[model samples]
Target: MRKNYLLGMALMASLSFYSCDKEVIYVQDGNGVESVADGAQIITLQVENGGDGLATRAGRPLYSAEAKQTIENVKLWICDNTGKVVYVKEISNWNTDGSTVYTTGGHGRQTTIELKDMDKLAAGSYKVYAVGYSNSSDYVLTDVTNVAEDGNFSENMVLSLSNTVGEEIFAGQMEFTVETGKGFKKPIVLNRQVAGAFAYVKDIPFMEGAKYLKLVASAQNQSLVLGNFNSVDLAGNGSGNDANVKYVVNGENGKSGSETYEISSIDLNEWFTAIKDENGDNLIDAGDNWKNPYSSEGHPTFQKGSAFGGEFVIPFAHVDGKQTLTLQLTNAGGNVLRSWKVNLRSSDEQLDQTITCWNSVSTDWSTEVTDESANIYSLVRNHLYGIGTRMNDDPGEGTDPEPNPSDPDDQPESLNNKQELVLKVNDNWEVIHGMELD
Candidate 1:
């Protein structure tokens, strides 16, 4: 059934007979109760969000899968030509019996709004503004007394991997002139003002005895102000050209092996574009502002060799097209040994795809066979970087063993006095043909 309501002059007298179910009331006329069109004019509005539901790169829903995230209520503000609000009305899922039922079914479907009472709309141009919430606690409506006195509306939409509950907010506006009898044609669609991101590091060589391994991005540790819906710096400051904005340290001790780190919380709209000052100012205008021109739709895919290095799917609320992201492999002391500057493609290809590190120098690692199915690309790189030799002997020349075993005397004669360069991945030693100590 079409939920209709009698608004304007009749609202005051009709409130005396309010019902607990919060159903719309019939507009009363001088003669008696009249049906819609028999007396009062009706204004219809349609509201919709972009798709069924926004989600993370891992395919997890951002809003409630059941569409319950959208609260069944909206607040409307009618303003005159001068932009001053004249009237305010809040239509909610209130029930006279105190048992409330709401518009809570449908995944990504448009909802409707109907307002009756053309009498309040004089013969002039007027503006109608509406705001709704996905969850009640996420936002609050205030002020809204009269045109001269308007209240402040607060908004809170938090997006993070850890956040499973939906907290989305939608808003729209329309302009219409009050005619003797006319209806609105166009509908309104609310735009989402936020984006999400997650990342994982794979096959990054951990520096041995280097304290700890840490993953650092060009933009990290930065907070974005939610009120500003449009800005190039929302993704981050181009400061990636100067200093790293964020860093996450691995809890495990640094050892020689292939490392993987996963993080699921990144706000694309949180702009941190200023060159971070030494004093660490949290204000948005505290430093030199350089806008980041990258869109949040894509993320960097890091690969040290043929294997995947790291995969990141970062989102942005604004900006468009391909974006550049830099991934760095840093030691606990803040030393970046290897970094990959990846240009993330615009589309689902950015999700669940592995990009090989184009700079990898392990041409022969693929041809070498190991006792176990392990990749020793990292081991070969470490050996060549240390010995100043481009190649090592075949597997028969020597044995590749773990360094500093419990019994030092049990070491092989061919391995004595030679620094052992070992590569480990998936808890197995990946012996390279030319990496054995001789």
Candidate 2:
């Protein structure tokens, strides 16, 4: 059963931004109007998904195996000019796990979300702030019921990064007007709100009696709030210095996960495989562009036809500075073999043949980077970064056993820089939406 979400219940909505037939569809009564419980005619918004919703498709990068467009619930706030939240409505459980299916001729799921409160307010201009999220519990609820014009709405209602990691945060804001008789009819396309960062572990040979590999992405905390803003992040607020938010991949055999702590990992042994050619050859491709991205002769490439490995992803709120990813290549006895500082902003043009570095991270995690072939320092919402690496026939170094994790003969090993692991983006990673932090 769908729970009652709206405290001051007024409207209901089901929207799909990218649709086929029509942008919006209204399945109304014979009178051509949805009658509300309070008899305040419904302001309808109809939408449907048109293919761009789920990003996981053929030839997509490994980390593309995530939910790009899945909005479970939405919280709406209709605020007046002075930021006074005059009306509030929460729509719960719209499209989830094929649970509710109101389709449009099988193109994609059709959605209809209705609005109320027009029967009370006078005709005027209003700002509609809508936030959609997958997990309801992650939202930091601030009562917008009686917010004052003295910036109370902006301070109270917000979404934080502490709990929303790897979760869906779809948000949108639109300005609309309400006439004397016509309630309110406007479309809200609540798109993804968090920037996507994913890491791929490839070309790492299953050698050296290696039992496990641990990968951790450490970033500054997302302490800012999503308060009546399109996105979060103060320009120079030092959010990039918090160094607390993290995404980890510790799965066995080079597997991956999407949790805050031990969210997911890779199975190292099962993660890597030699690229192949059409003539039943391994580590070779027909086009010659697929396999050898860096050098046609230096080392072999990873990711065969069927699958790839260590597809780790972290959904993050926009932080201020460059993020750090610490990779611990361990042996069977939990010995630290080697460390790597991944340059998430590794050149993407070699992958897409279009743009230079697009992310906006300053310093590399393990080793600081001065300049790059491509660099978009800041992480923005609705972007994707598919980052990967290549490990050659070198066994690098190793440390003593862990628990009391020791170094190689009490010797500390430096992290392998991104320039060493990744020379250029692979052709397989076609769409470079965004980049990892470091």
Query: What lDDT, from 0 to 1, does candidate 1 have?
Result: 0.24
- For candidate 1, which ten residues in a row score worst on lDDT? 9-18
Q: Each model's C-alpha lDDT? A: 0.24, 0.31
For candidate 2, write residues 210-311 as lDDT tens digits.
545554444333322332222211111111211221111101111223332322233343432322334543322323233323123232222321112232
Model 2, poorest ten-residue lDDT window? 9-18
What would the TM-scores of all predictions be?
0.34, 0.48
lDDT score of residue 365 within candidate 2: 19
- CA lDDT of 121 in candidate 1? 54
Score candidate 2 by lDDT.
0.31
- Count the clashes in each prediction: 17, 35
Q: 1-438 in candidate 1: lDDT tens per residue?
A: 112222100000000000000001111121123344422334332222111022332222221001112335445565677766666666564122211322221012232334445434555786555444332332222322121324333222122322322123333454556655543332222222222111221122333322222222222211111221110110111111112111111011112232222212222112224223333332123223322211133221111110111111121111122111223434445466444332221121112222111111332112221111111111110000010111111111222212122222121112112322211110000010111211
Where does model 1 exceed 4 Å of error? 1-73, 91-107, 118-120, 134-168, 198-324, 328-338, 344-438
